[model samples]
Target chain A: MTIFNRLNPGNTANAAPNPQGRQTMPDNTANQATAPESKRPQAVAQPLYAAAGTGGPMTSVISKALKITGQLESTENIQVDGQIEGDVRGLSVKVGNGARVKGTVYGDEVELAGTVDGKIEAKKVVLTGTARMQGDVIHQDIRIESGAYIDGHCKPDFGKGGKASQPSLKAVAGEKTSAA
Target chain B: MPHVTHLCIIPFGVRRGLSLESETPFMFTLARTVNGKPAFARGADQDVSHLGPGLTATGLFETDGELYVYGAISGRVDAARLIIAPGGVVDGDVVAQDVRIAGRFSGRIFAPHVTIDETGNVKGRVFHTTVTVAHGARIDGRMPWRPQSYFETLKELPETYA
Candidate 1:
């Protein structure tokens, strides 16, 4: 019985009722034990995500086997190595080799080494040697590698023409378009 | 009397080791058990997907392999195995062969095997063939058991709960 209690500390309250046949004693102990166990998960859960990386926020990884069919928005960095059929918004977005995106990508910095069938809007854009972009790119700064394949216009117009008005308008318009 | 003391001390040492192992993140341990292999046995580059923190994805995610979510997702997910890490939040239906939830899940789960960790907070029906719920897990809905065939023939998720 002691071994059983040691194995399952949470079951102590349940075992008490069976052994002592005292209902009130078990109830009070159960409440006390449960109250802390419920809160402990939250505190303990934080370390798992933290341990995934060195420090700071961890970058989201969309691995190659996954396929997503909707909008992805992240405040932190995003690394895409899979397939996405909708818009993507992030601080720093990296489209890895063999990955594919069929819609617009919005980020502060965007790097592409895969295939994008739609648009890209960012403050800084880097098209690696393996990038295959088939639509327009709007960026404040752009770099296209020698082997990159681009089939559309490259416009250096990101964050231009009334910066404040453009961002709000673009955000509203982007959401409306995606919804429709 | 010395033999009795030795027996007690050994079990105490073993119990301490077990408690320490349990403190390791639930997702990592659950993944290895369900896969029946080391978590990274499959080369680190493929067959597994990770949705890291601070990501909010709203869509349908379909994968033939494993999926580990540490972020938030509000859509349908179909995978061979799904692990909701402790900080993750998923608010939609999930169809998988195996599912281990250590986070907040607010939708129905259709799986052959389902395990809810102590940190899991689940609020919808769980249709599982085999289920395990750890102590301290908060589940606010019914868990209905089904035969193994019930999951093998599940081509599409039911639109509404029966």
Candidate 2:
């Protein structure tokens, strides 16, 4: 079947073609990672928009046994193996497997492989094998591995009243819905 | 690594601009050196060419191109643009006046301007006058330093340019 070029507002020059043997340009490496977060490829005609190469979160690794007294602000990736007594602002953050954080985390993706004693506001949160948390969680997606401990409220970011954005829940670690 | 002394030129076809569609895998084989340099064997029945600065080529499909491991490539690629397609691997540093990356690239990259697409994964360091990275594309390195200008590219022209 031929897909006639429709003069619509949401058509793209690089639209997916049919099974016809027409040669297609290779997928531009530019449209890889973060592009899926925003404007994904949909069958329905919505305003086609995607933000690429915006230089994702700035990251830093805190190794020694120091402390952050004030607000820890960043726009990159960060790995913490020390102690913090403040708030964190960035993208994905990981508490090292041998560190402790005593503050609130505000970011997109937060992975805790160590210990946290505060609150968290993230889109995707992961608790690895060696993680221990005693705080509240507000997240869209979460992954808790075996042998992890948590001592606070785990509120699913269900948009409103448990109605999540996705039709079906994306079970990460083989289990569907459980707050533990 | 031995410093590149010279660059060889080969012609395949002439076009104003070329874009490699993803349907077919792009290949560039360096058959022989224009300067009679010894060619190292990377694979059997492979095209061979030395990658370096101040080099130019006319028209050659990227059936196979030299992969620079820890060296630098500073030159003007006219009519022939090295297209690193999706999953395409460039093992060394790449320095070009005009470049477009749409695959996986390792080592350092130096260009006046670079466009890294989503499927593009770059590791190592980079230096450019201008840079642009599309979403989903990844750069696992730092912006190190810039290369020579297009004017300096002409400095080697006393033998080839002038």
Candidate 3:
């Protein structure tokens, strides 16, 4: 529970605790064209922790047809093969080849293979081939491959005075250190 | 079926990073139905977008292909075919052609065809033309019925609800 000090995914469920008590859903088969896929929830760790915002290390994919005009904030990995017009904050953000972004990107690790028209603030940054950047990049570690075009300076001050890394991530890190 | 080629283009669309238009190779595949018609008996290649369990996203997402959510997303999602795998959680409004949920969803949904699996925990409203709710699914809201035409003309979602 302490792992997600900022982003809590269980708040809604806890707020409405079992409103449908013993009320069985009707057996309606007319609308069911396909049978249920076998995707049972695994009996893993505590549901509270495992189902929290601090997901394991899985990645999220953003398809090409999708476009986001608002801010995208996540506590996990994100792969973007789409177009984004706002800020993106994630753990590890990967801008796929030919994708387009028009705002800042914040993450612990960020890899860009697309076109970015704004800034990037991260601990580690990688710009692969086919990347076209038009703004500055603030990172602690950076790698730029050949064929990547950049039109701005690369600053090595990520958490100095710029956008601070997510506090929830710090808490996660703190827990990992204490556990180790 | 003739639609198998369209189904194959879902993953190819993701790989090509093509813009939203008819120029992409994925568009020709969706020629049969484009106007929010609920997906039915689609090909086995129903998974194109995957959000793994360790990810969380907030904002609006729009797509014309298949999507699988095993993570957490809070916002608006518009897609053709969507599957919320077990352990996934979505808290927002969704306008999907075909939606299948095996996880937890708390919000308003407008779709032509909807499926709620046994492990699903849903709270709020579901506007559908055809819906199937499996046993052991927990619902704490309303499942309002709507005509297929209602979804076909749903090009512009009302900003009041979502």
Candidate 4:
């Protein structure tokens, strides 16, 4: 909690004048005068999640405490520091240290520092020193660092033939082509 | 999972296993202590999960810590404290100790404490022991008040409402 307080100094400063401003407003004109002011703090009081709605770069974070037991699809980058029990589709997927994924991960660029129990299909894949991949990886380019454990085949067949025909993967490829 | 139709009684303040703090300025605080006990035994960092706006998830999400949803979720969510931030959309059942909504929620909420902010739009039943609805919040269903024990002993959600 102290960390949050320290992180949101600007919000605390904005909130300090709120109560005093409300009390000083005349009762008759309070409705009109306080309306706009009341809305400002509500917007500012939101510490971290507020920026997600204001047209910022939307990178989805699956923190360490969460466990999602289903499919996750994202158009933006995804950083997983938690446990996921299903397929994940993202633009750039980063499996952080201590994270675990139990299903397939489809992305343009996939970075692994943790463990994946299933398959990975991407154009570019990076397996860090701490990565423990227990399933096959299909990628066009891959980098496996020392100390990385891989128990399955590393197939460089991504985006070749039917593998790229999947709807989600096609959408990702289409987005990339259109963006380029 | 029992189908029992009872009157909706709004309990203002009552004793429970987990004590609810009095009205505070901040919507939530990540206190180290939970229920008067140390939250972590290993001095681990507090786990706060955030589902950003660009994500869409379908399934059950379970966490012992706080969950902030800024994305679209369709399924069940279980957390100690859940916050649906503005622009977030959730469509499913939620089981939590404390639930705060500042976004769009369309499902059943089973919690001891619930708070709906001004921008919150709720379209389903809420089962709570205590609840707060801010001005300009839109709610389209009933909020049934149950005892704190009701949530503590809830193993299965009653499917009659769905």
Candidate 5:
């Protein structure tokens, strides 16, 4: 990339196309570059491109100004900048700053930079500094950045199937075995 | 064939109007030039919602910036500017300042500036101040023209008999 390309933000030309260069982009910068610049994620990219929809390949965006009052589910990634009053299920869910969600968020990876009044269930969960989580976080791996507010519990029991999720069932099974 | 011609008989903004069907040359240019500025530039940084392909969202989506849907939404959408990309589908009412549709919309649209692309398919009423429909666009509803000032105060849509 030339010096002019360095100054101009529009240049996504892979002059130095390496895995390391994409990781250098900031979190917010990834959103900007998604549509106009490039479709590369700023960090570790997941291998779910084909799940983004084969018929029409586009990102389902919930713009910052939009407010939804019901459920949202997507096979592809969802970037939310608006307010949602219902649950959101997607492959990757990004809740932006100033955004508010009153329902649960279910995804493979969930990143919260806003206020979520409901629970978050994902394989990987990231709570940014501006995140305000008022409910539980059930995840296998979790990263809570500094300044993130949490008013609920954090459980690291996720994706272990029903055994990890069903404590009450285990108690019932134990009683049956003991009686026998 | 002209049962819908009654939609254009409002006579509210008849005196200060441009011919609706005969202005073919102007229909293609209005969406590109608004106060000598690119219409897409208005979407810069403000629009944050982009629904990519194959996704289906069913809810009430309200936004101040543009909402670009490449997949589908089966609920109400209220935005400042809404762009439905090619193959996108919206199955409910939409209220916006400016709406550019290249996809399929099947509900009432309340907007000031409405542009329908060639690949667009519309199936409901469109209340617009300035509308431009490209050729080959399939429209199955009425396009009732309104004055620009009416849209400025268009807080709610008026009830229709249908």
Candidate 6:
């Protein structure tokens, strides 16, 4: 049986340091700190593939000013930079700065740093830095940066006693999963 | 099919003709066709719950919110739905309540409702209760093959009457 595994951050590739100046883990582990780059996770020779079914926690990054007219589903991570005109379904989605999207996003965790013109569904949503949104935001936890521009309703109902804080993207990032 | 219970089928040698056992969430069943026949089936008492070939199953086929089928897969499914993306290939039939195909598929597919997109290329037979085919989509399969319903039989008369 031939098993093919994904090449992680520090694996065999032309992966330089993340532009955000974040340091990757010396070993393979999800809890390792990460740096950012020009737009998306910059691993030149690496292929972009994730586990199926965004029904879990997934992420995707739409770099550049591209456009997609279909549903984006991933189970672990999602990041959008270009433009999406459909539903974004995943566990977590991060819209980078200068990104423009016109679609509905549903997930357990979401972060926006650009412009969105649709509904946002997640357990928690954080709008930081250069975010400008115009839609409904439903989540159990929310943090909007002082400079963030949002023109929509916000709801943080994770049930009584914060029962709605089940799948936290922050937790996923902090807790260090098995994936590196 | 109300008596339908969740089943887990793993082949001993990845061979077909193995019966799947109902009542287990940890065991994932991958049906493959070898030499034009079911070839592999095994059973594991432990939870395949969090492991698959390489992919992850988020409540798509298992109970613990994970179903892993480490490689390419084909067969019948009815639960969290199966999505065949572009460049993904599946052989044989797929039966589910809802299906989204963006790849290449051959053989028969039975679903209560089916959606084939422009990138979908389906040949062989289809037995959907209701179907939606988009433009640029390719489907060379028969539609509306429910014989147990009287209304469906009436709907079938139009083709015969014409």
Q: Scored by CA lDDT, what does every candidate get?
A: 0.76, 0.47, 0.69, 0.76, 0.69, 0.49
Please tell me which model should have the higher TM-score, number 5 or number 6: 5
In Å, residue A24's CA in model 3 sits off its true spot by 27
Q: What's the lDDT for residue A6 in model 4? A: 34
TM-score value, chain A, candidate 6:
0.55
Q: Please write out the lDDT profile of model 4 over residues A1-180, one tens digit for every residue.
A: 455543343444534565765433334354565676587546744664566656755778787767788789888889998889888998899999989999889999999999999989999999999999999999999999999999999998888888542357446445545754
What are the per-residue Cα lDDT tens digits for candidate 4 across B1-162? Answer: 111222122233332212444332111122222222323321144467778888889888866577888889999887777899988999999987789998999989988889998889999999998998887899999899998767655666788763
Q: Say which prediction, candidate 3 or candidate 6, comes out ahead on TM-score.
A: 3
Which pairs in model 4 have colliding backbones? none
Give the runs in model 5 whose Cα sits over 4 Å from its true position.
A1-58, A161-180, B1-44
> Tens digits of per-residue lDDT for model 5 on A1-180?
556655444456643453775545633465675554234321211232232335543456676546677667778778877778877878889998988888778888999999999788888999999999999999999999999999999998887778444233235335535754
What is the Å distance of residue B140 in model 3 from its true position? 1.7
DockQ of 3: 0.25
- Looking at model 1, give its docking quality level: acceptable
Evaluate every candidate with DockQ and list the scores. 0.33, 0.02, 0.25, 0.41, 0.33, 0.02
For residue B14, give model 6's deviation from the true position in Å.
55
The CAPRI classification for model 2 reads as incorrect
- Tell me the native contact fraction for each prediction: 0.74, 0.00, 0.49, 0.76, 0.79, 0.00
Off by over 4 Å in 6: A1-59, A158-180, B1-162
- Give one digit per residue, the lDDT tens place, for model 3 in B1-162: 122222322454453554343222322233233222322222333325677776666666656676678878888776766778788899998877778888899988988789897778999999998898876899999998988777755545566543
Ordering by TM-score: 4, 1, 3, 5, 6, 2
Runs with alpha carbons beyond 4 Å of true place in candidate 4 = A1-45, A164-180, B1-46
